[model samples]
Target: MATTPVTQGSTDRRRFRVTGGRQTSPQQPALSRWELQALLLILALAAVLYAWGIGHAGVHPYYGAVVRSMAANWHAFFFGGLDPSGWITLDKIPGALWPQALSVKLFGPYDWAAALPQALEGILAVWLLHRIVRAWAGPLAGLLAALVLTLTPITVALNRHTIPDTLLVLLLVLAAGSLQKAVGSGKLLPLLACGAWVGLAFQAKMLQAWLVLPVFAAVYQLAAPGSRLDRAWRLLAAGATALLVSCSWLLVVWATPPESRPYIDGTTNNNPFTLAFGYNGLSRFGDDPHALGAVAGTTASRTSGNTGWTMLVNDIVGPQISWLLPLTVLALVLGLLWRAGQPRTDGRRAGFLLWGGWLAVHVVVFSTSNGNHGYYTAVLAPALAALTGGGAALFWAEYRAGGKRRRALPAAIGLTALWAVVIDGPHGRFAPWLLPVVLMLGLCGTAGLWSSGPRTTPRALHSALAAGMASVLLAPAVWAASCLDSRYAGSPMSPLAGPVGPGYREMRHHGTKPRPHALNTPSVRDAALLNYLTAHRSGEKYLLATQAAYGAEPLLRATSQPVLVMGGFTGLTPYPAAHHLNTLVSAHELRYVLLTTRRPSTSAVFWVKQNCTRVPPRAYGRIADGSFTLYDCAPGV
Candidate 1:
């Protein structure tokens, strides 16, 4: 998405600047030497932050196993099917997995390869966001926004995983930048292109991608040069194009005979359309009474008392993303006020509306929805960074303009900084030097903004701005650093938002652990199970069966042998009913079953206990944590 910020792009040719009404360049030049150097420096920093010691970042094993399976066959790859044998498709569309599958396939399906693509994609998002902001505001704002996004804890955590959210965000940013070009230049093509990018994002993540549609329509209607009627028609055309692009994959997957492909994993009826509309769609906004868990396998029932306006303060979201919440709010307010004096059709106002709409929509939807996860806050990171970064820079410029507005800008920043420090302050386990550095910057920036001195020393202003940036940047930077240093990894990535200390608590709700349970791998127990399964197999369709993918994942990745996950992801879904499992056993299609002591369904545990011979712990080497029991489906004839 952030394809080299070169000069002469369609979006850059516009006359109006996002920071103000400055006009000079006919075609925006490439990043100057300082700009390029600065950009690379931050990108390097981001790379280190995102990928350093990344192999240890315990990515979800279920997803990792699916990618491994996907690498074995293209049909499984295309369908996001859970297994290579094409037994069940993953809950969501397969678009997001394509890149991960390729990476795993090419790199031998290791943890590093599974996560590297998403990390790189997240880095691209940083650059793309910088370019987009730079095109609207200026280089300074762009750099600031980029840095803020880079340090976002949730951003780091999610990017370090194999989840599709990072890629989905990159596609959205690309779509938004294109839409801005369409509005600025009155070009139909850019609008179509924007639709295409967003459509692809929809393929990556279904209903959530459409959140920005209203903003896109409004920006074109308000700012594009064409007549209102003309713009409306063009908008409709773009919408149709988006629909076509979004549905392209869905149609193909749906058109394929159900019997020929795997049953869509998350749906009751084995249909992609039903999965999209049911489990992964509206069910995300509200829990499905009949369903056992969220599509993301997160529980929405834990509120931490976060509802209504208190949503911002909730233990779930506050630490990960709300550090700059106040600043973004101020940005929306000030950005709007700054533009109110200009033409009603001013593009700056449209930019605010676009980011503001995005901020508001996600906040409200996540705030109100019971099905929200703490990691869902990753969606909020970009909008907050764009507004706060670009908005803060805009205020600094206004203050340099030397008026009452200038004085107000300092007070505004000071208050916002105060809010951020208060919200995230308790979470920082900083060295003694850290607080002083943050305070000094806050004071210097506050003084510079507060000063009514003559316009003689710009260095003072620069110092103040740096201080402000430092103050805003400090806590999240520290916390994100802690996230890397801690043993923390895996899904529900946002809850571990604070530093690795007291305030950094996980959300224990809806029958799930508050944090990722440490997975034991490469252990003697696992090796023993693998050895037993490998030795006993004789033309069986599956070498093993487990209550959930979690137990079988180590073996799945260790060998090419197929494993039947009796219950899907959560181990609660009623699958391969007792009789059906017996049928498979009778046919010698499955032999070994591993019953994890963790949340297996009652019926499933009962079936395994009554029907199979329980292998003694000593017979299979050391079983750590007393968490799993290996059973022989039928040891010998």
Candidate 2:
């Protein structure tokens, strides 16, 4: 080998040359062995959190319906058992069903089988998030981020359920992380992977996936200095890949015969392709503004139009979860300040800004839209976690630079741990005692700033402090897990002993009743109905129809039946009569109708009750001590 000693600094900023055969600066310490072990522990905890109440929780009803529906109808929509019917009928995308269907096929229609994948995915998402943040910001930031997400109340709740939200969260994190990598390296493969992740996200929840990419691209553009054309080309490629991946299902559906379409409601346009792309795609932004008023029982005529910005904000952000408002505002201010102070060479600062910006965009867009759901706010967890991590990192770094820096770190850690104990400790249930702990954490951060010593003290102290804060944040989560165990240990109603105010008491009463209660025991009734349909049905080739859209999951579970609701898309609700049911009933296409008392007014039940002779309610077995009723719609007589 010819020996040419390498220089320490190369003229080319982009290129790296080994100096005297030494590695170009030791690899940055992303995760120490201890940090790795801690992360694995956190991941294990997340898995347990997601898996503990999988089958026993009331959340299973909705997922059960999805599994049962897919098992029964996969052939009808895809293989031609029910001619003209497709695989899914909900207003949502078909991406969520594939996992559920696979679960049913492998695990034999078990609710846990359908739910376990989501739990595992949720854990994977948390782990991946930790890895991404740790790589960029160091293990401390990564640990804080992971802990925040692990303890998030809504994140924990969504992970245990079978809905698409958790899956979407996982996909979004993966896409964002891939985009972060692609932006750094400008490699085509990472960008393509980013596109594929976004496509999966879209498959999970439709166009919400697209909303995240622009935010990521803008961050990349600002962080990386490149020709405008180059950036544009990369974005275009990524977009094309995303579209290709996301539209694969739509393409399959489009190529199939009209009779082979598995879903109802949104499936029947003069041009199914146009309807799928445009109406289902863009119409949601317009339709969601009216959903709240519609939910509140206001007529479309009486409600403000979808374009009204104020009403949109009120509907989506204000009522969804009021706790998020202050935290979001604080995070934005802190994120901007953090970005402004950082040196340009510190890529981690840019990553923080980008993640924070992505979070802000989610809040802003969702807030301005007409569509609102409490769970939709779950997307903000990563941003909040990052912001909290950043704040804590800054505080800890400052604390580590002082003469009393050694003491500072321990003091901060001790104070934080004490706060967690006082506020969230089992004995601290009295509301009056909670204020001092909050005041102490705030004072500790404020006091660190006024200290004459170096800034490192505050950063190290806050890092330790952040971990303690995460413990406090997670106390409710620990309690919730214990409550779930208690619920499963005896009766589902046993967990209700602690909270019994008017609202919950009413819910308990209604949940115990035979009729459908949307809030509490909807899942129980749904599961029972699914079981009843499955035991009574003879053929693997039966078509199941539901007037109630939300009830589709339970129904699906009971019979391993395919449903007629809109495939999980945005505007598949109030399922149209002249278009959806009239065609199916008149053609005598469906074998059975699983009617529930919980049907929304726009459901097929209302229409069937009005048009067809009411069939007698057949006794479906009870679940959670509540009864489910099944009805058979006679062939067109």
Candidate 3:
């Protein structure tokens, strides 16, 4: 019984070809003109939404301080002039000051100057992702990836605020994009551009540039096995170029006078490069007794470190919205597996690997280094979005394959949407039925992808699928927007309606001002006493002694009275002088001693309180508020 021979052409006709693969059929065109139009429309919509809310977001107080200080002291040739009182400490990366300074020069002294650059960078990042993914993945994947990034909660928040993270992220993404193009096309110019971007990333955040490099190299090697050595050399050259570009300012700072160095070194220190590159970098990794009050000081409490990490992650990724948390983990796993299988075809897979690797490196380093913050996780978000996009695409494809499988997609989307509405919804009111509505939409999308699967389908279904993906990506953004209106826009429906919330009710009843509570508030009578000194002394430079003297620098600078805060680790200031100040405040220059009677509850506040006793009571003024006393340290009273 001889079976009829199965012809190759007949067999090929029956097989279902994956979209964008080698299989060709006249019936199924690669991508309809309409699909391309839909994708572009989605990209445009995502860009507008991401960029729109940036100006309105509340400013981060610390970052705001950094920007203001830089703006107030901007000069054409040298950045900010020397720390007036020789008490400078933070001078590690002069690069961080330039951009803010440039913003001030261009837009005048406003918070918007500092923030606008980051917002623009964020929009550019979205555009880059769209282009990169569209080049490699299909339009569907490109649209999904871009949408996910645009509406990501953390991404939106960071874009809106003035912080280094957004700049770092933008530069990192650009570097990744350049590297992707360089590896794909084997172009030296792209490689050189990649180096320049890496340098920009380094200037933005110091040493964090290397986080993305290894992953890019690894992915490139895996993707193009034959050209591994050549790729490695190109990457090395790029890194060298970046190092040269980034370190130019530092090299200049190193050659400047010690007095001149106070602006870059922060303190009257030996070498700016050694202090910043060494103490600022290595000391952060290792424990140091002299580093107290510094960002990485041993005396710095765990809470501060943890809060930093938490803020970092929350700003980059959406707040671990309870409903999305588990799904995010699953998505990450699926994304990695999917990319692993796909390998590096057009640098898309490599890009994913680089992002994932960068995120992982920072998480491990910070988590283990006794310093971790949620905001640090921002670096990983683009990669996470890619993963989520891939996972969503895979899930949709599976859902379309079988009716039983279809339920899972709806269930997931329903729960996520329901969670958003319940916790992040416009009103406190719970809409239980909204879950079903989302589930129905999910079913519709599944049907669309299924019917459109490897064959023809109605244009509306394609549009619906694209819309659904956009909605998914916008989930976090919409929730955030709702929160902003509810909290900041005078909406009674805001979930934060009680005493602890932001508005008239909060300040009128709770004694908590709507303003950010800076450490220099007059709540400490010493702060008031210091203000009084500014009134009386007028123009005389004074050294303020205390462990956390720098805490009051912004206030002191406001008075145009130079002050050197004693007894804290150097920040804004260079190392040796920072170390000297950490040891003791010279009583000759220290004309005013601010003392707090009570120990501070938190570590930062504690540092402020610890140095208060260094001044002699005989030289002090009458106690104000029973919590603090001010002393006039002028020679012989």
* Local accuracy of candidate 1 as per-residue lDDT tens digits, 1-637: 1111212223322334333322222354578899899999889888988888777654565666777888878878887767777777666788887898898888875778877888899899999998888776677778888988999877887877667788888899899899877766667999999999989999888878888888788767776665678888999999998999988888888899977887665555556776666667756555563343333343422333345666666654576778887678888897788677655456666778888888888887766766455566788888888887678767766665555566656776577667765665554554445656666777777877586477747686667767777777886787677557544433433335443312233322343334332222445556787776777778889878887666867666655557787666656445667887888888888877888777546576688788898777776676443888878887463
Residue lDDT tens for model 2, 529-578? 55565665545344566544444543444443346653232223444453
Model 2: lDDT equals 0.53
Ranking by TM-score: 1, 2, 3
Q: Name the better of 1 and 2 by TM-score.
A: 1
The per-model lDDT (C-alpha) reads: 0.71, 0.53, 0.50
User: Which candidate gets the maximum TM-score versus the true structure?
Assistant: 1
- TM-scores of the models, in the order given: 0.87, 0.70, 0.68
Tell me the spans in candidate 1 whose CA falls farther than 4 Å from its real position: 1-25, 291-308, 428-436, 487-495, 500-521, 572-574, 577-579, 596-612, 622-631, 634-636
Model 1 worst lDDT window (10 residues): 1-10
Best by the lDDT measure: 1
lDDT comparison, 1 vs 2, better candidate:
1
